[model samples]
Target: MSAEEIRRAAAERIEEAEDVRDELCAALHGAGVVLPSLRVEPAAYADERPRPLVELGRCNLRTARLIAEALRRGGAGA
Candidate 1:
């Protein structure tokens, strides 16, 4: 993607992630807890994997939705 497109995507992701994180914090606060940092374990690797070990990545608002969904599924959506 072009630099402009990349910047736009990053900005959107930041905004969306911030919004979701804030909502999550508020919900946790109501439940007498503070939200902590996200900790993702490394994915298992296999020699037969089709993709390369290192791959280019992009971020956008969709990532925010994913994060929110993950937290909900983990029972952090109090």
Candidate 2:
């Protein structure tokens, strides 16, 4: 594919990854689990490489426990 096509695809992938991040954040919120650093990793799309990534960055211990509990109770993860 052309450079423009590759760029467009990467852009689309990044957009989709961002959408997924938002959805996950919202879902976690509904489950009372908040990860302040949740985001799309810029590096994933930096070189227009394949596959974008949604990053759930570090959260505090309390938040980590909350997420674990939520998962245990089959909350948002279910």
Candidate 3:
């Protein structure tokens, strides 16, 4: 895929993942489990050819695992 196509696909996936994370957070909150704030940030490096990166931040180990499982069930992960 071209750079533009790659970026577009990445953006769509990022949005989907964000939705899943939000839902997971809501469920956790309802269950009285407080999680750290989650944010998606650009993760591009100053390398030869930089691409887009969707970094999920502010999650501890347990939160990360929970988010991964949620994404997988939502068909956003492998």
* lDDT-better candidate, 2 vs 3: 2
Whole-model lDDT, candidate 3?
Answer: 0.58
Q: What does the lDDT come to for candidate 1?
A: 0.47
- Candidate 1: tens digits of C-alpha lDDT, residues 1-78: 887776666556555555665675566556444335431112412222222122214435655565566667667556
Backbone clashes (count) for model 2: 0
The 10-residue segment of model 1 with minimum total lDDT is: 47-56
**Regions of model 3 farther than 4 Å from truth:** 38-78
Q: Give per-model TM-scores.
A: 0.42, 0.85, 0.47
Error of 3 at 12 (Å): 1.0
Worst 10 residues of 2 by lDDT: 44-53
lDDT order, best first, reads 2, 3, 1
**lDDT of candidate 2 over 10-61, digit per residue (tens):** 8888889989999999989998998888988878766666587788999889
- For model 2, what is the C-alpha lDDT against the true structure? 0.86
Best by TM-score: 2
The lDDT leader among the candidates is 2
Candidate 3 — worst ten consecutive residues by lDDT sum? 44-53
